[model samples]
Target: MSAPPSPSSPRPRPRRPGRAHGPGHLIGAYGLLALTALLVLIFSLALPRTFPTLDTVDSILSNQSIPAVLALAAMVPIVTGAFDLSIGYGLGLTHVTVLQLVVHDGWPWPLACLAVIVGGAVVGVLNGVIVVFGRIDSFIATLGTGSMMYAVTGWITDGGRIVPGPQGLPAAFTDLYDSTFLGLPVPAFYVLALAVVLWTVLERLPLGRYLYVVGSNPRAADLVGIPTRRYTVYAFTTSGLIVGFAGVLLAAQQQIGNPSVGLDYLLPAFVGALLGSTAIKPGRPNAIGTVVAVAVLAVGLTGIGQLGADFWTVPLFYGGTLLLAVGLAGYAARRRMRTGAFAARGSPTVPPRSPSSSTQDGGTAGTTP
Candidate 1:
């Protein structure tokens, strides 16, 4: 083997400073922490016995799991410098398809469940192909695809709800959402498990580095022999698969296929993903940050909903959070760019030339202006 790199030889760059560890990062971490604590404290004080109880925590987790899943799903595309707008519509389609397959077609519940999940995966793959091979902009492509999914959902459900069978459905399947694990609901456990696996892969694996490079500079990644298209397609496909799985969870939890329910989930999911970029791994989408973001929304909204807040207020909160998150991400990205610019300027090895040094005659060569 060749000798190891010498100290005098050029070294690879040090790890890039993650946006989450920079100045003012603590502000977000502490802000979210304080907000979470304050919300719990106030709700405890205001509602007394009801708000601080175990049942309340269970309720929040149970209700929040579906949105959390969708948020995590949304985060995948954002990592690849894109967004999956079809998830909300995909949720609607998946649920409706599941209901029709089982309740209407009289298929066995196990087979029906399998079919729906496969359908969701197929949808995801189609999304990836469309975006990658078609050379379409992710936002516009997903928008169109989302619209098509909405139409499919409407067609499937006949624009009405698909109620689950009271007796025909398996108890074990229905209980998927209701069961408890370690005194917490099963859905919460699912979220934790999924987040852990995803975070581990994205943060610790080589694939994540490839994804980051492609997201930051696709052309550069391509020049360096990274398969930019392949990774981009994988990102979209994976995003679709998660969203599809989230749909299964929603069907289990709701016990109905309501076409209208899915769109309501879209805003909150996007909000969680966007807001997540402002924390943990700021300026980049990360699993833990996304989970924390969803938790923040869940806690805040749960408190608000308990306080008898108007129904419209939640959407407004989500929209406002999205705006704030976008602003924060923009600021972080700009700061990173400025940091790099200044670092390049400050380096002693990259010295600036004097005005007199460019002369054709050697008289002024190496002279200081």
Candidate 2:
């Protein structure tokens, strides 16, 4: 004899949508992953020489590493139903901070890096405060902060590139991005490690569940005694910290501070984050899905480049993908909530889903992403 789910437990860890039988279920669960594989296979067949080589793999991994980190960074506050548009400018500001400290001021590379990363965390705290206390929308708050960061970045570089003398940067600092580990680009590992850590926090920890509750329904979360404000701030802080670290990596890779580089990453990061919410664990912005989304984008971009697509194609793809991901994410979220309610209460008829509904009491799969 088995015990039933107690109604007292508000969250019952709804089964994954893929658990259902049928091709549709399987496709819905893994369409993105399949698309990635299919893209690779098609490209390998079509562009035999350039597309199927280690150099291509290395290039994709190396180039996309920073964007992937930014995507993950964007994904964090999203889990709590908030956005942090400041990341792009913040990334620019932090990396430029590193360049200003290390190259111009001649600070020790390690110390410069430490200061920049810490500064990122501080900025995160500020963003959280602005959103929670200042009562501004996260999008608006982050956008303003991001603009300020861009201004500061321009000030640091005086609207030009920051380049070290012909002596170049310290070898050790350069190695941070250039070195390889376990036959993969080291930066890729950073993305992987960050994703793994986030996955552990959001999928396996109580703190993560609390954040989900906050994202799903703030009023309900408060009624249940969760500190929604504090947790929202925590999410922003974590995002800031990751953005800071990514800035360090960006600095290492470019070895020059270009004031305008950061804005370029803004679109792709959101594309990956929103698109990501539709895979791995559909309807929620999970770390694994974000990673998979990054991979797909990388593959698609690489394939497009190898195929000699026009310059405008990249931005076109990104914009189209962003719109598609947002729609899919919203739809997936609503369906998941409805289906989850059906499964949890064992009610034959699923309830109409509301935009503000929360997930089960103890579960973590709620977010409009």
Candidate 3:
């Protein structure tokens, strides 16, 4: 039999380099960021008078903040391999609820805000129950629940707007959206703060690891003794709470309740969330990535608007970008899987020895063959 590998023998090196440094890795790593920069540069050159101004910066930040928040919210459920389509409808219902309480019921803004936020949590819990215990697919389940939310929103407003009294919404409430700190909109700060919080939770906390494991492979997570269902529920609940907060910001920003506004956000939110998976972490849904994705969209959209594009341009751009994002995300996922498979196949293996060979090897030097 051949001798065992000698202590001084060199190990067989892998045929391919590290996956993280493989060809095309650079593209996957910084493609979106580079595109964002390119867009900014182009816009600055195209509209030197308008695109590079502080006003444009503030506009992008202020307008994109809600969608950014909603995108982050959508990402939470995705971490646990689930979806929450109801976010849009929930936002509508939540803002309307807050308005109804403060305007019609004469409730204090703080109390009304608290009630709406709590109600959002309840809606999240219901979604969790439906998805976990009821065994309904998250997409279909959330769709149904979202429809119900829309129905409820319509009933609340009787298909009419909820405008605040002549005195206008409480200053504190409006200030939540309108106020600027350090030369930037408050909502932009909200986005940053929320991104930091989410990043900390997902990158530095055990719960985040559990959710990721559950998302990557629920069966494997279960086999490893992880309470996958519980974490999945937690993900949905967290997503609901974030959506609720975004709704409050929406209410504060608009100062009126319009049930239709929520649905308009759904597409952009999903675009940001899914597109984000292809950036920052590359192949995983992450908060910072989502924020970056939102920023990219905001820049692109704002730049295009300044170019005097037709009314249909916005939808066209978003639709095309969404498709591209999905395609790129799928490509990243497939590439990761290929890299893993190649690594697995290249791993060293030991050949099994027969019983006779084992016995012979262990025998004395004078032993018979």
Give the winner by TM-score.
3
* lDDT on C-alpha atoms for all candidate structures: 0.80, 0.90, 0.89
Q: Rank the candidates by lDDT, best first.
A: 2, 3, 1
| Model 3, CA-based lDDT | 0.89
| Residue pairs clashing, model 1 | none
lDDT string for model 3 (1-369, tens) is 675544575646554522555447778877788889999999999999999999999999999999999999999999888999999999999998889988899999998898888888889989989999999999999999999999999999999999987899889989999999999999999999999999999989999999999998999999999998899889988888998899999999989999888999998999999999998778889998899899899999999899999989988988999999999888887877777677668755344444655555683333333
Q: Specify the poorest-scoring 10-residue window by lDDT in model 2.
A: 352-361
When 1 and 2 are scored with TM-score, the better candidate is: 2
Candidate 1 stretches greater than 4 Å from native = 1-23, 28-30, 166-168, 340-369
True-structure RMSD, every candidate: 7.3, 8.5, 4.9
| Per-residue alpha-carbon lDDT of candidate 1 for residues 112-146, written as tens digits (9 for 90 to 100) | 77877777777877887888789999888998999
For candidate 1, report its TM-score. 0.85
Best lDDT among the predictions, by candidate number: 2
Give candidate 2's root-mean-square deviation (CA, Å): 8.5
Query: How many pairs of residues in model 1 come into backbone collision?
Result: 0
